[model samples]
Target: MIAIQALRAYNLFYFSLLSVFISFLPVYLSYRAVSPSDIGLLVGIGSFIGILSQPFWGMISDRRKTIKKVILLTLGLSLLVGFVLFQSSELWLLFLLVGGMYFFMLPTDPLTESLNYRVAEQYGIHFGSVRTFGAIGFASASLIIGFTVDQIGMDRLYWVFAVYGVLTYLMCLVIPDAPVSSKRLSAADLRRFLTYPATLRFFLLILLAAIPHRTNDSFLGVYVQSLGGSTGLIGLAWFVAATSEIAFFALLPRFLRTGREIKMIALASAIYVIRYALCAVVSDPMLVIAIQLMHGITFVTFYTASIQYLYRIIPEEWKATGQTVLAVIFFGISGIIGSFAGGWVFQEWGGAALYLMMAGIALLAFLYSILMWKREEREAETLAGEA
Candidate 1:
C-alpha cells in the first residue's frame, strides 16, 4: 500500500514537471526572441541527443538491475542543467544547455513508466489507476502554470519547474524498487531482440503514428499564440485536453485487453486523421481548444495501447531496454523529424499549412495501421492452428 501511494505521488509531481517543459518550453523560446525555425532546430537537436542517450541509460539500468538509481541520477542532472538552461538568454548557450538537459531528462520518462508498469503488475494493481495521477498533475499544472506565467512572466518558469522536480525526487525516494531481471543481458542479446520482424514492424508503426502527435506537442502553444490567444488560453487548451484523459485512463483497464491493443491504436490513428484535418482549417483559437477535447480520446488511446502491445511482444529480461527503444522511436526520432519539419513549416508556410501536412501524415498512419491489424490477425490465426 505504501509503495502504491509512493508511485502515485511520484507520478503526480514528475508529470507536473514534465508539463512545464513540454507545454511551454517552445513558448518560452519564442518569448526570448528566438525565431520559430531556430526553436525547431534546437528542439530537434535535443531529440537527437535523447536518441543517443536514452538507450545508454536503459542499458545501464538493465546492467545494474536498478531503475531507481538511474532515475535519481538523471533527475539530479536534469535539475542542475535546467537551472542553468533557464538562466541563459544567449542562443548559443541555450543550445548547449538544452542538449545537456534533454540528455538526462528524456530517458527518465520511459524508465519511470517501466517502473510504474512493473510495480503495478507485481502488486496486482491496475496500471491506469496508478498512472491517472500523472494526467491529473499535467492538467492541473498546465492551468496553474499558464496563469502563473501570465502573472510572473515566462522568465520565472524555472522556479515552478524546480518545485515539481524536487517534489518528484523526494517521492521517488520512498517508492519501492521494481523486481529486477535475473538473467544477464549481452550486446548480442540486444541485437537479436532488434532483429525480430515484429519488433521492426511495431517500431515503424509507432514512428508514423507518433510524428504528428509529437509535432502538435512541440507547437500547439505557439500555434495558439499565433492565433492571438493569450498564455492563459494556452493553459486552458492543454487543461481541456489533459483533463479528458483522466476519465479515459480510469476506464481503460476494463476495456483494453491484451490482443485488442493494436486495434485500439488503429482506431486512435483514424481519429487523428480527422483531428488534424480540423486543426488545419480552424481559425479561432477557442475552436482549436474545443477540438483539443479529442486529445483525451486520441492520446490516451494511442499511448496506452501502444505501450501495452510493446510489453506483450518484448522479452521480460529486456523490459527496460525495450521501453527505452519505444521511447527513442516515439519521442526521440519522431521528435527530431517533427520539431525540425514543424518549425520549418511554421516558419515558411504558416501553422495552417503545417497542420495540413500533419493531417496527410495522419492519413498515412491510419492506412498503415490497417495493414498492421491484418498482420496481427494472420499471426493469431497461425498460432491457433498450431495449438
Candidate 2:
C-alpha cells in the first residue's frame, strides 16, 4: 500500500516538473533571445541525444534488473545539469547544455512508466488510476507555475524546477522497484525483437502518429505568443489540456476494453487530423487554447493505447527495453523531426501553415492506422479459424 502511494506521489511530482519544462522551455528560450530556428535546433539536437541515451539506460536497467537505480542516477544528474542549462544565455552554451540535460532527463519518463505498469500489475491496481496523478500534477503545475513565472520572471525558472526536482527525487527514494523477468535476455533475443514484423509495423505506426504531436509540443507556446497570447494564457491552455486527461485516464478501463487499443489509436489519429485542421483555421489565441482541449482526448487515447498495445506484443523479459524504445520513438526520433521541421515551418510559413502541414501528416497516420487495424482483425480471424 505504501509502495502504491509512493508511486502515485512520484508520478505527480515528476510530471509536475516535466510540465514546467515541456510548456515553458521554448518560451524561456525565446526570452533568452534565442531564435525559433535555433530553439528548434537545440531541441532537435537534444532529442537526437535522447535517441542514443534512452536505449543505453534501458539496456542497463534490463541487464541489471533495476529500474529504480537508473531513474535515480539519471534524475540526480539532470537536476545538476538543468541548474546550469537554465542559467546560461549563450546560444552555443544552450545547445551544449540542452543535450547534456536531455541525455539524462529523457530516459527518466519511460523508466517511470515502465515502473508504473509493473507496479500496477504487482499490486493488482489499474495502471490508469496511478497515471491519473501525473495528469493532475501536470495540469496543476502548469497553472501554478505559469502564474509564478509570470510573477517571478522566466529567468528564475530554475528555482521552480529545483523545488519540484528535489521533491520528485525524494519520492523516488521510497517507491519500491518492480520485479524483473527471471529469463535472461540474449543478444539474439534483442535482435529478433527489433526485427520482428509486428514490432517494426507498430513502431512505424507510432512514428507517424507521434510526429505531429511532437511538432505541436515543440511550438505550441511560441504559436500562442505569435497570436498575441501571454505566458499565463499558455499555462491555461496546457492546464485545460492536461486536466481533460484526468477523467479519460481514470475511466480508461471502462471504455478501453481488451483488443480495442488499435481501434482507439485509429480514432485518436482521426481526431488529431481534425484538431490540427481546426487550429490551422483559428485566428484567436484563445481559440487555439480551446482547441487544446482536444489534446487530452487525442494524446491519452493515442499514447495510452500505443503503450497498451506495446505491452501486448513485446516479450515480458524485455519490458523495460521495449518501453524505452517506445519513448525513444515518441520523444526522441519524432522529436528530432518534429522540432527541426516544426521550427523551420513556423519560421518560414507561419503558424497556420505549420498546423496545416500537421493536419496532413495526421491524415496519413489516421489512414495507416485504419489499415493496420483491418489487417490485425483479419489475422485474428485467421487464428480463430485455426483454433
Candidate 3:
C-alpha cells in the first residue's frame, strides 16, 4: 500500500513537470524571440536525438538491471541542464541546451512506465489507477502555471519547472525498485523481437496515428495564441485536455477485461479524425479549448490500450525495451516528422491548414486500423478452432 502511494506521488510530480514542458515550452521559446520554424527545428532536433537515446537508455536500464538508478540519473541531469537552458535565449545555445535536456528527460516516460507496470503487477494494483495521478498532476499544473505565467511572465516558467523537477526527484528516491531480469538482451534477441509481425505492424500503426497528435502537441499553444488566446487560455486548454483523461484512466481496468484494446485504439484514431477536423474549422479560442475534451477518447484511450497491448506481447525480460520502442516510434520519430512538418505548414499555410492536413493523416490511420482489426479477429478464430 505504501509502495502504491509512492508510485502515485512519483507520477504526480513527474507529470507536473512534463505538463509544463510539453504544453508551454514553445510559448517560452516564443517569448524569447524564436521564430516558428526555428522552434519546430529545435523541438524536432531534440526528438531526433531521442530516437537514438530513448532506446539506448532503455538498453542500459535493462542491461544494468537498475531502473531506479537510470531514472535518478536522468532527472538529475535534466535539472542541471535545464538551469542553463532557462538562462539563455540565443537560438544556437537554446538548441544545444534543449537537446541536452531532452536526451535525459524524454526517456523518463517509458522508464517510469516500465517500473510502474511491473510494480503494479507485483502488487495486484491497476496500472491506470497509478497513472491517473499523473493526469491530475498535469491538469492541475497546467492551470496553475498558465495563470501564473499570465500574471507574472514566461520567464518564470523555468523556475516553476525546476521546482516540479525537484519534487519528482525526491519522490523517486522513496519508490521501491523494480525487479530486473538475470539475462541481458543481445543483438540477436533485439533482432528477433523486431522481426515479429505484430511488433512491426504495431509500430507502423503508431507512426501513422501519431502524426496529427504530435503536431497538435508541438503547436497547439502557438495556434491558440494566433487565434487571440492568452497564455492562461492555453494553459486552460491543456488543463481541460489532461483532466478529461482522469475518468478514462479510472475506468480503464473495467474495459481492459473486454479484450477490445485494439478496437479501442481504432476508435481513438477515428476520434482524432473528427477532433482535428473540428480544430481546423473552429474560430473561437474558447471553442478550441472546449474541443480538447476529446483528448479523453483520443490520446487517453490510445495510450492506455497501447501500453496494455505492449505488455501482453513483450517478454518480461525485455519490458523496458518494449516500452522504449513504442516511445521511440510515437514520440521520437513521429515527433520529428510532426514538429518539422507542423512548423513548415504553420509558416506556409497556417494552423487551420496544418490541422486539415492532419485530418488526412488520421483518415489513413483509421483505414489501416480496420484492416488490422480484421486480421486480429481472424487470428483469434484460427487459434480457437485449433483449441
Candidate 4:
C-alpha cells in the first residue's frame, strides 16, 4: 500500500517536471538568444543520443538488479547538467549540456514504469489508476506554470524545473524496490528476444503510428497560431488533451478485464484517423482545440493498451529493457523522423497537407491492426477446434 502511494506520488512529480521541461525549455533557450534552428538541432541531437542511452540504462538496471540506483544516478546527473546548462550561452556548450541532460532524463520514464508496474502487481493496484496522477500532474503543471512564467520570466524556468526535480528525487527515495533476476541476458538471449515475431510486429506498428502522432504533438501549437489563435488558446488546447487522459486511465482496468487490448489499440488507431483528418480540414482554432479532446481516445487509450500488451508479452527479467525499447522507438527514432519530415511537409505544403498526411498514416495503421486482429482470432479458433 505504501509502495503504491509512493509510485503515485513519483508519477505525479516526475510528469509535472516533464511537462515543465518539454513545454518551457525551448522558450528558455529562445530567451538565452538561441536561434530557432539551433534549438531544433539541440533537441534533435538530444533525442538521437537518447535512443542509445535509454536501452543502455535499462540494460544496466536489468543486469545490476538495481533500478533505484540507476534512477538516482541519472536524475542526479540531469539536475547537475541542467544547472550548468543555464549558465552557458555558447552553442557547443549548450549542445553538450542538453545531450547530457537527455541521456539521463530519457531513461527515467521506462525505469519508473518498470518499477511502478512491479510495485502495482505486488500491491494489487491498477497501473492505470496510478498513471492517472501523471496526467493530472501534467495538465495542472502546464496550466499553472504558463501563468507563472507569464509573471516571471522565461529565464527563471530552470529554477522551477530544478524544484520539481528535487521533489521527484525525494519521491524516489520511498518507492519500494522491485525484484530482479540473478541471471543476466546472454548475447543469444538478446538476439532471440529481438527476433520474436510479436515483438517485431508490435514495434513496427508503433513506429508507423507514432510518426504522425509525434508530428502532431510537436507542431500543434504552431498549427493553432497559424489559425490566429493566441498563446492562451494553445495552452487551453494542450490542457484539454492532457486532462482527457484522466477518465480513460481511470477506466482502463475495466477494459483490461475484457481481454481485448489489441482491439482497443485498433479502435484508438481508428480514432486517430478521424482526429487528424479533422485537424487537416478545420479552419477555426476553437474547432482545432475541440479536436484535441480526441486525445482521450487516441493517445490515452492507445497508451494504456500498449502498456498492458507489453507487460503481457515481455518476460519478467527483461521488463525494463522492453519498455526502454518502446521508448527508443517512439521518442527516439520515430520522433526524429516525424520532426524533420513533418517540418518539411508543413514548410512545403501547409498545415492542412501535413495533417492529411498524418491521417493517411493512421489509416494505414488502422487497416494493419484490423488484419492482425482477424488473424489472431482465426488462430484462436483453429486451436480450439483442434482441442
Candidate 5:
C-alpha cells in the first residue's frame, strides 16, 4: 500500500538536506567575513518573514483544509527563492532572498507534522519511526556538507543549498496534498483559540525558553570552527548530535507519561547550563565536540515536548496559529536576537559570555517552569471545582 510512510521517508530525505544547509549556513556566512550584525540581519529578516508567513499559511490551511497545495506552492516559492539567493551580493538582495526562503520554508515543519499525525491516526505507523528518517538524513548530510566545506570552498555551498531547495520542491509532487479544511475559522473559533490562557502561557514559556535554547543551533558550527576545528569535525559533531537525536526520538514515544514532558524540558534546559559552560571553558577540540550530545535534549527533547504541548493545548482550528506562535516567538524572532547577541557576545565578552548568557537564560526558563506548574495546579483545581 502506498502509505503516509512514504511521506515520512520523504520528510527525512528533504529535511536531512535542510540539516546540511542549516548546519553550515552560519559558519559559511561567518567565514565570508560577513559582519555578525549583518549575519544577524540576514538571518533575522528570514526569521521575521518566516514567523509571519507560518500563521498566515496555517490559517489558510485551516480555512481551506487543503494542505497539499499549500505545501507544493510553498515549496515552489522557496525553490525560486533559493535560486534568487544565488544572484545576490547586495545586502538587501540577500535580505530579500532569505525572507523569501523563510516564507516558503517555514510551513514545511508544521504542515509536515500535521500530515504525519493524520497518517498515524489513520494508520498504525508511529510518528517517531518516521521522524527517525529525518535524523538519519541529518546525520548523513552533516558528513557530506562538512567534508565539502573543507574540500571545496564555502562560496560554492550556496549552489548546494539552492539545488537542494529545488529538489525539496520536487519532493512535494509525490506526496499527496495535506487534507485541507473547508470550514472557515469563525469568530467563536477564534475565541476558542484564545480561551486557553494556559496554552498561551505555555507558548510564551517555550518562546522565552527558546531564546537561549537555540543559541547553540545558531552558533555552534562556527563556534566549533573558531576553536580551530575543521568543518569536517564540525559536521561530525553535528552528525553525532543528530544521530543521538534520532535515538532519543526512537525511544521517546514509549516514555510519554504524565509530567514527563515538563521534566524532559526542565532537564534539557539544565543541561544547557553545563553544555554552554563547557563550550566556554573547554578549548580541546575533542572535548568541546563531545558536548554536542547535549543537542539530543536541547533540540529533540525541548522541541518534541513543545510541539506535543501545542498539539494538545491548541484548539483544532487554531492549531497552525499556535504552532506558528512558538515558531515566531522562540525559533524565528528569538533565534535571530540570540544569534546577533551570541555573535556580539563572542566578539565582546568572548566565548565564555555566550555560554554564560545561555546559562543565565536557561535558569530563567527553569523559574518559568516552576511558575507554569503553579498555574497548572490552579487550573486543575478550578476544573475540579467546576466538575
Candidate 6:
C-alpha cells in the first residue's frame, strides 16, 4: 500500500499533467484558426455547462460520500471527448471538444483537493508540502510542453492531451484507499451551507479575480510569441510563475500561515492588480516574465487561503460541494466571461488596455473582500449580543 503522502503527491503530479495540457487549450484553438470571440464562446459555454454540472456532481458526491464514482465517470467521459478530437477535425467539432473536455475535467481538481485535505488530516504530514509538488508538476509541464511545441510543431498537441488523459486514468487508480464519509450532513446543514451569505460573496470574489486572470490565460502565448518569444521563453515564463508560487508556499507556513484566510485572499486580490498591469505595459521580456513570477502570490497564496476558508465556512457534508462551487464560479463561469472579454480586448483594445481592465477588476475584488471581512465581523458581534 502506498503511504498516504505518496498517494497525495502522485495525485498532484497526475493532475498537473492534465493541467498543462488544458492550460494551452486556448492557444491550440487560436492556432486552428478559431476566432477570438468564438474561442471565448467555446471556453465560456463549456465553462457554463461545467458550472451547471458541478452542483449536480457535488450532490452526487455528497450522496455517495466518495467521489470515486464521479471521478471515474467524468474521466471516462473525458476519454471519449479526447478520442473524438482525433476522429474529427472540423471547426465545430473543435469548439465542441473544448467544452466537452472542460465539462469532464473541472471536477477533478476541486474534488481531489477535498480528498487531499482529508488525507492530510488523517495522516500527520504537511498538506502544503505534499500538494506543492503539484505546482511543480504544473510548472514543469508548462515549460516542457511549451518547449516541445516550439521544437516539434503544434500537430502533436491533441496527442499530448490524450496521452495525459490515459495516464491520468491510470493515476486515479492509486488514490489512497480512504473510507467514504458515512456521516452525511443533514438537510438542515446542507441548507445552511447553501444559504451562507459568505458563500455568495466568495463566489463573487472568484468572478472578479478570474476575470483578469483570464486575459493572461487566453493571450499570454500570442503576446509572448509576437514579442519575439520562442516556446522556450514561454515555458520559462510559466516556470518563473510556478517558482514564485513555490516560494510563497514555503513562506506560507509562517507569514499569513495561520488561519488568517481572509487576509490571504485579500492580499492576493491586491497583488493581481499589479501583476496583470505589468503584463500589459512591460516592453522587456524579462520584465514580463518577472510579472509571471507573481503567479506565486496570485494563485498559490489565493488558492490555499480559499481552500482553508471554504473548508472552515461550509457544512462538513458539503465539503466537496463547496469546493466545487468555487471552481464552477471561478474557472467555469468567470473564465468564460473573461475569455470572451479577453478576445475582444486583445484584438480591438490591445493587450495593454486588456491588462488595464483586468487591473480594475482586481480593485473591485479588493473592495468586495474588505466589505466581506467587515460583514463577518459585524455578524459575529450580532450573534454574541443574542447569546
Clashing pairs in 2: none
| Candidate 3 deviant stretches above 4 angstroms | none
**How many clashing pairs in candidate 2?**
0
The digit string of per-residue lDDT tens for model 2 on 1-387 reads 989999999999999988877888898899998888888999999999999999999999999999999999999999998888877899888888899988999899999999999999999988898999999999999989888988998899999999999999999999999889999888787789889998898999999999999989889989999999988988998898899899889877787876899899999999999999999999899999999888877999888898898888888899999999999999999999999999999999999999999999999999999989999999999999999
Q: What is the lDDT of residue 96 in candidate 1?
A: 97
Task: Please give, for residues 233-253, the per-residue lDDT of candidate 5 as tens digits.
Answer: 988888888888888888878
The clash tally of candidate 1 reads 0
Candidate 5 least-lDDT 10 residues = 176-185
Q: Which residue pairs clash within candidate 3?
A: none
Q: TM-scores of all models?
A: 0.98, 0.98, 0.98, 0.91, 0.90, 0.91
Instruction: Kindly report the root-mean-square deviation of model 6 from the true structure over all alpha carbons.
Output: 2.5
Tell me model 5's lDDT, rounded to 2 decimals.
Answer: 0.72
Instruction: Give me the candidate number with maximum lDDT.
Output: 2
lDDT (C-alpha) at residue 151 in model 2:
94
Candidate 4, residues 127-151, lDDT tens digits: the string is: 8878888888887877777667666
Displacement of the residue 274 alpha carbon in candidate 2, Å: 1.0
* Superposition TM-score, candidate 5 onto the true structure: 0.90
lDDT computed for candidate 3: 0.89
Taking the tens digit of each residue's C-alpha lDDT, what string does model 1 give over 162-277? 88889988988888888888887777777877998888888888999889999999999999999999999999999888898899989888879988987888899999989989
Per-residue CA lDDT of model 3 for 171-241, tens digit only, reads 99999888787775777777888899988998888899997899999999999999999999999999999
Q: Cα RMSD to native, each candidate? A: 1.1, 0.9, 1.2, 2.3, 2.4, 2.5
Model 2 has an lDDT value of 0.92
Model 4 misses residue 74 by how many Å? 1.2
Ten contiguous residues minimizing lDDT sum, candidate 6? 14-23
- Arranged by TM-score, best first: 2, 1, 3, 4, 6, 5
Looking at model 5, the pairs that clash are 64-181, 65-180, 65-181, 66-180, 68-177, 68-178
